[model samples]
Target: MDTRRLYSFIKIVDAGSITRAADILHIAQPALSQQLSALEAQFGQQLLIRSKRGVAPTEAGRALYRHAQLILRQVDLAHAAVEVSGRAPAGSVSVGLAPYSMGAALALPLLRSVRERYPDILLHINENFGGVISEAIMTGRMDMAFIYGAGPLRGVQFEPVRSEDLYLIGAPTDGGEAGEVALEELAEVPLLLPSRIHTIRQVVDSAFQQAALRPNVVGEVESALTLVNAVDADLGATVLPWSAARAILDVRALTVRRIAHPVIRVQLSLVTSDSQPLSEPALAVHDLFLELVTAFDKE
Candidate 1:
């Protein structure tokens, strides 16, 4: 039978009344009754008995109910499998990642590899916060993601890739790459920081809290680039992922200082949904992530 009829039958069975099922299904009671009648007629058996209270299923109805449930489940699986099969290695793979995480720099290497090895794979990358990236993966919108550790994130599996120390960044005039910095130094300095929602921001806040130091947040920007730029212009120094700040320090106009006390080194991870099966493109991308990790480790 068609899905409509099966749905009608199932609703009736679940609601135990034609009227109630019709209300729940948002169909007219008469229409539901007619559909059920048609379904039974198609099967050439009596499926329901009408009564004052509601409708009850017959032996034949019960038997068909079991089969119908399985049929619907199979149909759903078939549709999902077909969708997945359509997404071959050469197909599009949407990825969501934290802005300051490997999602930006490391994504380039992975993209290059995918292009050279699997040209058919389409890479769609979105920059977002860690929580947003996790949500995207869980909802099946993102095939995979690179996010910094947010403790134990449920429903998403983490594959530890690399760790980098969170460094204190300032102008070259203020401090060159002399060495590590004390938390108290940050407390006295004006800080340009990202929102507390960012994983790195949380780390910085925790370090400050541990040292019992309250930093003066001069400004709060969304992107790492903006935060770094603000610091470069001497708006204020900020805590940054080493990878991001290192690129800026090469400019000669900026200097990077390592945070010594309460060393807040954070781990970056490749995360994927535990509930969803990976597409071929997704698997290839995941492999490239591992390769990048290996290369980074060697460095």
Candidate 2:
């Protein structure tokens, strides 16, 4: 297989136009088109659908794009490994941190630690939802991620970091005091939570189901800032892990009550690709992440 053709194909797919890809690759448009044709002939499939607007990948092209990304990443890692052996690891490592969890608190600290310890290493940090981060890791677009679930996911491995207890945060006017609150008591309280796709929402929903009670969820909020703001405005109460609640809310200004009568806890895990081995720089960042998590847990 020609790696050059694969690279060109990826560029074409990303740019969405043969002319744009040609400009980016510094190759003639005719030559780039020939490469695309050769790739199509070799695969015996029409990889892309060309239209007046641009080129879009076919189903086969999407599959090839995924494989090509992994292959190119592996090739880069192999070169970096050999070139940086017995030297300070120097390369870029992309990491994802799932929002609305412990990741929110650790982002800045992790960035500072990496910058101080591995000056030669360039770190790319992405804060997103768990599903998005997980898919990026599975596709080899991310070296690793800290996510909020330990459930089995194909094409990735999860290492348990810690579990966090859920709490109810509300405005001071709506709450009586700061103490443990039962699930039954919250059945009537208007709630603001993330969508059903989120792991936190899934856990909250399951607890409600097991208790044989339906929560009065008034809104589905995906943004941490918006959720906190809504709760602060007395629009509705929200359920979140203690770390996330504290990181985004001022305890003195809000009422944070731990949920009792069957405490709900969510697992935090470090996720990595099952098939792709981390490069030296990525491995270094991974170790640093674990170390920081451990220290934070102790504190």
Candidate 3:
């Protein structure tokens, strides 16, 4: 396979227009079209669906795009390894932080640490849901991520960071207390939580199931602001890690209580692609993240 054609195809997919890709690549439209044609012919499949809006990748094209990204990233890593050998690690490192987790609190610190320690390296930080972040890492679109799961994901390896205890967060007037509450007591408390697809929801659900109790979930909320606002409005209570809760809410205004009596906990892990080796800069950031997390845990 011609890597040049792969590069062109990737650009076309990203730009969503052949003309735009041609302009970016500084090549004639016809030449770029020919490269696309050659790729389709070699693969014996139509890779794109064209329309008035532009082109979108077909199923095969999406798969190829994922592989192409990995291939291109590996090539870049190889070039960097040889060119910057023994020099300060330098290049763009993309890091994903799962939203509403301990990662949210670490973002600013991570940025400052990376900027101070590796001035030559460019850092791209992304805050997103765990599933989206994990998929990005698996596809080589992100160098690493701190996500909420340590379970088996096909293309990624997870290093367990810590098990964070889940706490109940509610409005101040709604029995504002600092003591631990049992899982049984939460069965009747109206709750607002993220959807079932989220790791926290899954953990909460499983814990309730084992206790043979159904939680009174009043609403499905995915936004941090909405969740905090809903809780503050006395619409319902929510569950979260202390770090996550503190990141989004003012502890003084809300009631925070640790859940106990069958305490619920969620695993946090550092996730990286199993098949792709990290470049020096990425590895450096990875270690720095671990160091920061360790120090934060101690505090």
Candidate 4:
């Protein structure tokens, strides 16, 4: 059986509709339907039940889908084995990262290091919000991502990098809010924060929910830079890691205070899809990320 058809079959099952899968695969809908039909014919088993809502896998299709995912990953691993043995790893490695995560600070340095280490390797970085990055990884749009602390996502694996303390950032205050500030203080201080959809916002809200405190939200800003700027202008305070607010920290006008009365730390993790195999170039970059973390520990 041709692996391309098997791959196409898995895509249809994941998408739950031939038209949706075709749009994602960038193939005509009829051609995609034909591929599915041919696969079922070749196997002499009905694979899908298409209805008005969408398509769903039959019992046979469910069994094949499980095996197809494994088979395709193994085939890709075999190809990766050949590529690694041939020469220095070369090809594009696409990584998804959230703008509010540590990835924002590391992107430039990591790109430079990869170029110096592997001249032929092309590194592609896509920055997005945490939820979008997770979806991209699940759908195979990205090889991996550095994302916020999240519960298990289907077909995704997360390896913890480090935990970082969250800080309360604002303009220099005559109130002498220096080293650390209490969580209760945030109840009174107006907050400039991301909306509920973002993972960091979820984390922040959960922490407050548990403590029975509510921050007075002044604005729900999407961009990290805008949140920092609002804090710098003394409009309100914001909570974030140093990595997310590094640009504004350079200015002398801002004050940084670690959250206390109960500390909050966002867990950073290196995430990858379990259904995919890493290519030689992708593996090399994954190793580089670990090395950078080791170096960071020393500093």
Estimate the lDDT of model 1: 0.76
TM-score of each: 0.69, 0.92, 0.88, 0.78
lDDT for each residue of candidate 4 in 230-280, tens digit (9 for 90 to 100): 776788878788776673445356777888878888988888887786778
Indicate the TM-score of model 2.
0.92
Pairs of residues at least 3 apart in sequence or in different chains that clash in candidate 3: none
Task: Give lDDT: candidate 3, residue 201.
Answer: 92
Model 3, 173: alpha-carbon shift in Å? 8.7
Q: For residues 1-299, write the lDDT of model 3, one tens digit per residue.
A: 78999999999999999999999999999999999999999999999999999999999999999999999989888998888898998999999987779998899999999999999889999988888988898888899999898869899999999989999888333353457888888888899988988899999999999999999999999888888788878898899999888888787787788998888999999999999989999999999999999999888
Alpha-carbon runs more than 4 Å astray in model 3: 15-20, 40-60, 171-178
Better of 3 and 4 by TM-score: 3
Over the stretch 1-299, how does candidate 2's per-residue lDDT look in tens digits?
A: 98999999999999999999999999999999999999999999999999999999999999999999999988888988898899987899999988788888888888999999999899999988888998898889999999988969999999999999999888343354448888888888899999998888999999999999999999999898898788888999999888878778886788788888889999999999999988899999999999989998888
Say which candidate scores most in TM-score.
2
* Backbone clashes (count) for model 1: 2
Off by over 4 Å in 2: 171-178
Query: For candidate 1, lDDT tens digit of each residue in 1-299?
Result: 58879978988998999999999999998998899989988999999998998888899999888667656654654565566675545566777777766556666777688788878777887889888888777655677888899357777898887788877677343453367777777777788877889888888888778878787888888876676567667888777777766544443556667777667888888888776667666777888778877886577
lDDT for model 3 comes to: 0.90
| Candidate 4 lDDT score relative to the true structure | 0.80
